[model samples]
Target: MNLLSKIDIRQLQVLKALLEKRNLSKVADQLGISQQAVSEQLKKLRHNFDDRLFIRTSNGVVPTPFAQSLQTKVTRALASIEDLLIAEEFDPKTISTTFTICSTDLEQTVILPKFLTLLRKHAPKVKLAVKTLSLDDIDSSLLTGKVDLVITNPMFAPNNYPSTTLYQEQYLCVASKDNQDIAVQSSISDVAKIPQLVVSPSRGEFSGAANKWFADQGHPRNVVLSVPTFTAAKACIAHSDLCGFIPARLLPDPTLKIISLDKQVPGFDVIAVWHQRSSQDKLHTYIRELLMQAASE
Candidate 1:
């Protein structure tokens, strides 16, 4: 197979639009190019792919099998490239744009509130579009331009995607006011043996690195019930005899104990990851940088 050159990206995009829109005039209108130009691009694309790419039908142009197979990947690759170009030319003050991001509920609940408030005060014109996606979905989404950023704690994709560490993923052992001695636990085993409350994202993603730590430490632990947020987890521990972890930044509650795991279990670092391709877009670049700054401080 021959390598796809940069010039081919535009041709593939035309094929993509043709495959989707079916009508030459409609495709041209959507692309803001003349119908003749669309036809010329399509002609070039058909020659390059050597596949009909699209076939005329009563309804409109229909993608051939080969074109159908190649459409998504080609579109995503082109989109990734587009993101890189746009990000390279970004200007935060003058340009107004929206960015889509995928993150854990914990990050959404805690960090996003702060980030939104900050952006509102400083960058009112900027907009954010947040969605929930499992860790498993991030890379494919990035490939397809589904989400601009993926935020995680203690780790990133195994693919070695570019990432910026925001802060330490903190964990503090906590108990109810009646059982404040939770912090005095000496070992992971000791902490584990304590009645524990579990908090997991909608995708079963744990808020932090505790699950991984448990697996690595060669320990099997017990979990009572899984809740949604740190606040909820805190509520469970406060009302019951259970103990669990919270972010270190959240100070100990008077009714609920908080103990930093600085000694027993290491804090996981926060990370914001994006495809290197994301750096090409002015919007992606500005938002990624702004989020990076938000994550760092």
Candidate 2:
């Protein structure tokens, strides 16, 4: 048992590399050591394992049948250990991880304003990085470790990612308080003729309720402008008579009127998404809980 305890990790790594790359020089390069060192380690490994781990072939070293038999199990066991050691274990107030979040103009409008204030008050040390989900490659972005958190309307989930609804989203139109036409708001269709300000999160988002409303009704309203984000649309609507569709919560100004759409567009579900690596993380849970409570308010 004492002799078995003396067996080293370096010997295992060298043996695995020699079995994989086959050439002495290639394994030496992988281990960042000399070819002679690999030979020495290989000799030690053979004596300890009491097996001919590799056979010298005409071209390069080939693993013996016994070595091949142990390879798969050994590799998996080592990988499991590696994952356990490298996993993220977080503490919110003490954490200094810079978390990147992907959100739309709409999410930035509805969620971020309040969320940021909450963050500053509670977790000042935690850093937040914002990225617009500007492309359809959201899954790839998360999988490749590009983004940590995603806040999108109705957090629609894809395979390899889990989702939870952060909030319920309702849509309404915002027009300037002084705009005369807004005072006569009878129905959604009544304002169809108004110059519309629409937001497509991705440069050309044609799928939202605002974009589809006019065409579906066979009455194409005058679209004064098309912007990529709701924040931009909100700014445009603020200073002009152009009507913009926005979430119900964001219109905090008392001067602005809040009326739900008569036409039922699907309600948006705000969600937070991260890779499986972060799913069990404590800090992720803490931030998520805070956002969830904020949404409820």
Candidate 3:
């Protein structure tokens, strides 16, 4: 008889329980089976593997090197099976999980407020964890299950991963309402000459997305300051003589005013990206939909 023919899913379950509990009685209780049944399953498992998978001890049992090596593989297999079953019977209201999102200050300010409101209404029990976006760590973090979603410009998102464009965001040339030099309807050349504050979150350099636009108009931005976040840039621009481009959604501020340009500045698409492992996950799909809705609003 082939060894594969003798093995079954129940045997694998028994092996997993035993590996975790280490005691036959505990494994049996957890699985709602008798100790004799567990031992019988173990006996078959040992015979199939042709190894003494565990050794009897005063404490109950100890896994051999061979059995120890199987722990990760077995755990992963069981989790995958569980995910498969959950996908078929998923309900958003019943889910009680914490999802982590990686985002910049811009998304946190504009997207998260709406997304959180919808999330709370739809899945009250679901929690959220927000991590500041780190360009250097995004690839490894997504691959290692550190972040569930990334909300940012499509250009910054990981290449070839699953992503959906949430919305398009336009930039507004904003300056202090009190600034006498830069006024509304300021030309691009005029705005570029003023001491400009650039939001360069990922890098410390003074360059920004609007650099190419400025260069095309025969004017290079005189970036006098480089802040790491939009919040900081906004504060600095409001108090100082500095001006910079900010997302349009973050407007209506009492402290700053929008500087109408001679020509409209280009906008970029905001996108949500996730790991391929979550492509079939119901929760991820629903969350992506919520993001789109939130962006639209």
By TM-score, the best candidate is 3
**Which 10 residues in a row give candidate 3 its minimum summed lDDT?**
81-90
Q: Write the per-residue lDDT of candidate 1 for residues 223-295, one digit (tens) a residue.
A: 7678756668778888998878777666557877655443466677767878888766656665666676666
Residue pairs clashing in model 2 are: 154-269, 154-270
Global lDDT for candidate 1?
A: 0.72
Candidate 3 lDDT, 29-147, residue by residue in tens: 99999999999999999999998999999999999999999999888988887888773677788899999999999999998999999999999889999999887777888899999
Q: Give the local distance difference test score of model 2.
A: 0.74
True lDDT of residue 266, candidate 3: 86
Error of 1 at 275 (Å): 2.5
lDDT of each: 0.72, 0.74, 0.89
- Give the poorly placed runs of model 2, Cα more than 4 Å off: 1-90, 113-124, 155-160, 205-207, 213-220, 254-266
Task: Give lDDT: candidate 1, residue 40.
Answer: 88
Task: Give the candidate order by descending TM-score.
Answer: 3, 2, 1
Task: Estimate candidate 1's RMSD in Å.
Answer: 14.0
Report the C-alpha lDDT of model 2 over 172-224, residue by residue, as the tens digit: 77786667666534455666777777776675643445556566776566776
